[model samples]
Target chain A: DTAVSQTPKYLVTQMGNDKSIKCEQNLGHDTMYWYKQDSKKFLKIMFSYNNKELIINETVPNRFSPKSPDKAHLNLHINSLELGDSAVYFCASSPTQRGNTGELFFGEGSRLTVL
Target chain B: DQQVKQNSPSLSVQEGRISILNCDYTNSMFDYFLWYKKYPAEGPTFLISISSIKDKNEDGRFTVFLNKSAKHLSLHIVPSQPGDSAVYFCAFGNEKLTFGTGTRLTIIP
Candidate 1:
């Protein structure tokens, strides 16, 4: 079973368009996170949610928002996508916010391309 | 500022040899560290981890060593196989996880 899964694996959109990526986890984890991997392969945290409560919000632009409907789902929405928004977005989940194991289960990742 | 940094962009190792990947961090608050491996078209999977309290952790062919004083950590793979070729990332975890730029490992037979 896929512990963490994200939909719209590949998205190609034009500038100024809006898009959303959906993510879900079945590992009974309490924390979920959205991460962006740029072209240089640098993974940076965008947002984190614990039990549907927003916890960590990196210095991401307001144009990007993350919503967690439940403990098991976290979705990312991009408003007025720009070329700089093109990158791979990863969804991850952990058993706890401060996981002693320090391990996260990650989804296959959603690749976004803005022209 | 990037708290975690992997200076090596790529490392090529011959089969049956040891592969050493190094990572450094600037945050002293980060008490937990982890290593993850990712293949093309796939998300990273957890490989091994070490806490600040310990200096080394071993799991089969993978071993992670931590140097708290220098804030340096390294992952060692013994007899690296071709299948071990992938991009490896080192991460520090506190309130949130911070990842270093990945280092791509190529194991040549």
Candidate 2:
């Protein structure tokens, strides 16, 4: 069984279109995060949620929004996507900060291509 | 500004040799650093990590050495095998985690 899973492994959409990527983790972790890996291969943190509370939001465009329905799920929704938004999005989960090893269990990234 | 930087985009090493991948960071406040490995079409996996209080951490054939004064850290894989070929990323954790662009390590037979 996959620890962390994201839907729509590959997506190709037109600019200005709206899309959402759903992520779920069965690891019983308290913290979940979204990360973007651009063309340069740099992994940038977009947002983080701990037990359904928003935390660690980076400076990203307002078009990108993250929703956490529970501690085991975090979903990313993009409105009016642009070409610059084409990248691989990764969903990760980890144990809470205290007594944690800082190890992030990541999902096989969802690749988004905006044309 | 890129806080974490992996200057070498790619590196090639002969099999059974030591493969060293380097990373540098501008932030001295990062409390912990980690090395992650990734293969094509896969998410990066945690390889090893070291804390700001320690200079080195080793696990099996993989070792991570951190030099806080120089703001640099490196991952060394001794006697590298073909399966060890992958893109390596170094990340620093403070309030949040910041990652470098990553260095692709190629092990040639």
Candidate 3:
């Protein structure tokens, strides 16, 4: 079984439109995270949820919001998408909150292109 | 500011040779260091990790070395195989990992 899976592997949309990417983990991890890989290939953390509660929120735009319905699912919705938002979004999960074990399970990334 | 950086964008190694990828970070508070290998269109898979308290950890053909004083981390693959060709990322932190850009390793057959 796949430990983590993401939907909408590739998305092409016009600017100002709204789009959402969904991620689910069957590994029974309690901590999940969202990271954006920019054009420079830098992976930056956007948000993190631990047991359905928001924990880490980096310096990101307000247009982006993350929703965690349960410990297994985390969804990302972007409002008024911009061209600069074109990047690969990765969803990851760790077994513990602090990840003291130093391991993470990631999903097949969702590539979003805003035209 | 980018806390982690991968200076080398790519690296190439021949089959049965050795492959090394390097990473540097500016923060020293990280208690754990990790390496992840990613294939095309696939998410990164955990390869190896070393705690800040230790200098090295090995697993199969993969090994990770952490230099806390220098804030440097490196991944080594011995007898590199074609299957080892992929992008490798170095990350550090306890709660939230800060990842380097990534180093693309190409193992020639």
Candidate 4:
């Protein structure tokens, strides 16, 4: 089974349009996160969900929203996508083991392009 | 602000030599640090990690050294192989793992 997966591996849309990226993890992890990698290859955390509860939310723009209907899935929706949104979005997950050092297993990443 | 940072954008090392990658973090609350390797068109893979209590951890040819006081960590690949060429990312783990800008490593055969 694929540990982490994302949908729409490549997305290209015009500016001011709306789009969504879906992600799912079969690892049964309690925690999931979203990260953005820019053209410079700098990865930055956007949001994190733990058991359906939002945990960490970086100072991202208001147009971006994350929805986790269940522990196995987390989806990102972008409204009025701008050219700045053209980058790779990655989804990762980790098991809920406190005091245990857990590693984030990332998905292949969804590449979004806004023209 | 970038919490975790890899100063070198790229590094080249010959096969059969040691390749060292350095990372620095400013957050003292980070209790765990990790190294990830990524190839183009693929997700980053967990390489090695170390906790705050341990200063060093080794797995096969990869070794990670952590200095808490200096907030520094290094990944050393001994006898680097040609297949070891990839982008290395260092992360500082808190509620979420903050990644660095990544360092592209090339191994010359």
Candidate No. with top lDDT: 1
Q: Give one digit per residue, the lDDT tens place, for model 1 in A1-115.
A: 8889999999999999999999999999999999999998889999999999999999999999999999999999999999999999999998988745778899999999999
Report the C-alpha lDDT of model 2 over B1-109, residue by residue, as the tens digit: 9999999999999999999999999989877899999999999999898988999999999999999889899999998999999999999885467999999999999
lDDT string for model 1 (B1-109, tens) is 8889999999999999999999999988877899999999999999999888899999999999999999999999998999999999999987677899989999999
For B4-93, candidate 4 gives per-residue lDDT tens digits of 889999999999999999999998988789999999988899999998889999999999999999999999999999999999999987
Order the numbered candidates by DockQ, best leading: 3, 1, 4, 2
Q: Is candidate 1 or candidate 3 better by DockQ?
A: 3
On the 0 to 100 scale, the lDDT of residue A71 in model 3 is 99
- Model 4: fnat (fraction of native contacts): 0.64
lDDT of 3 by residue, A1-115 (tens): 8888898999999999999999999998999999998898888889999999999999899999999999999999999999999999999999998646668889999999999
Measured over all alpha carbons after superposition, the RMSD of each candidate to the real structure, in angstroms, is 0.9, 1.0, 1.0, 1.1
Off by over 4 Å in 3: none
Per-prediction TM-score, chain A only?
0.98, 0.97, 0.97, 0.96
Tell me the TM-score of each prediction against the true structure. 0.98, 0.97, 0.97, 0.97
Report clash pairs, candidate 4. Answer: none
True contacts kept of each: 0.80, 0.62, 0.82, 0.64
Model 3 chain B: lowest-lDDT 10 consecutive positions: B62-71
Q: Which residues of candidate 2, in runs, are more than 4 Å off? A: none
Clashes of 3: 0
Which TM-score values does chain B get in all models?
0.98, 0.97, 0.97, 0.98
